[model samples]
Target: MSDEPDETPRLDVPVGMFEDIEDLKSQLAQLTALVEARTGGDSAETVEAVSADEEEPAGGDAEGEEEEWQYPPFILLLDPPEYDDELRGLIEWVEGVLVPGYLGEPSADAKWCHRWFEHSVAIARLHAAWLAWQELTNPVSCGNTGPSVWHRDHLDPALRELRGAAGPFAGCTKGEHRVEHRLPSLVPSAWTHEDGA
Candidate 1:
């Protein structure tokens, strides 16, 4: 060995690793397409349809040009949980905007409420828990008893209900081990009906 240390970092991937990754990606895309086709719903098409339903034609003569599709307002609040300012903003938006807006609408099916992971109500609750988690884990904030208070008052109870055996994803799994489960959307009819009545 030479006295001089090597400065460059080396990747020791197998020669065929890149090709294997590409093949896996291709398989995933195909599987995604298959699932979309089976469900009779594509995200792009759904957005387009929702836009068409909500928009008014500017003029009858403008039909020659394609209309720009706009996503539903709920899409903005459907992001996965995060740990930064984005999570704080999402918590505020969900609490101040989404919760109130959803409450004003007709009540959702109780049967479908079991599917908490797929529902807006559950998302809002989960966001609240994530916010609490941030406060509890922060070394400089929320006091020393913050974590205890959060667990006793918020996180434990919420998680107990949300992840219980009788919870929304009850049919999806029996315990902690993940199994193949076909979870319908929060709206039963939306997933069941191709016309989306």
Candidate 2:
């Protein structure tokens, strides 16, 4: 109610707000020191002032900088079943789940590499496929395009080649029909017949 006009600016804040102001100032000072140490004090202030969005070049130079192609890291199964059980599980999973789920109804014309599960290559491929399935189906990791990407990039091609007519199980069939087949060996034969001299 004094005639003299108030000079101090009034601020609306909690009563104890000033008590934490010193602590906040101490924290800010420590953070600034840490940043200076990490950056060697060279242009640290400039780096801090520049926003992430504003850091990029505003010209075609940015476009010219091509990002290096990065393949996703291969993730192996945590507890792969024992060899015999592994093979059985793999075959069961592929036949029961992957095949029907991804490729739809198994065609009589297309043959699955029946002996495919026996080979190391098939094991590796199936393992990769299983990992991809896990990643795409997982709620936390599966984003909007994850499923489509998995189908396009991994599932379709693998299933197609795996079920191709001339694939690993070329002569094998889903029916009871028996087909004699054996993988050709690359090593030269050690046995040589003695020539009659």
Candidate 2 deviant stretches above 4 angstroms: 1-92, 103-109, 113-116, 176-182, 186-197
- Over the stretch 1-197, how does candidate 2's per-residue lDDT look in tens digits? 89776887787899878879966875565555545554667675637644543675655354444331112323233244345555666678788887676554456555654456664555667767766875676443444566888888887777666667655455566653323453665665557555559
With candidate 2 superimposed using the best TM-score fit, by how many Å does residue 76's alpha carbon deviate from the native?
11
Candidate 2: residue 38 Cα off by (Å): 29
Candidate 1 lDDT tens digits, 147-186:
7887787766665555555544344432232222434456
C-alpha RMSD of each candidate structure in angstroms? 22.9, 18.2
lDDT scores in order = 0.52, 0.59
Score every model by TM-score: 0.30, 0.44
Runs with alpha carbons beyond 4 Å of true place in candidate 1: 1-121, 174-197
Minimum summed lDDT over a 10-residue window in model 2 is located at 68-77
The residue pairs in collision within model 1 are: 114-168, 115-168
In order, how many clashes per candidate?
2, 1
Among these predictions, the greatest lDDT belongs to 2
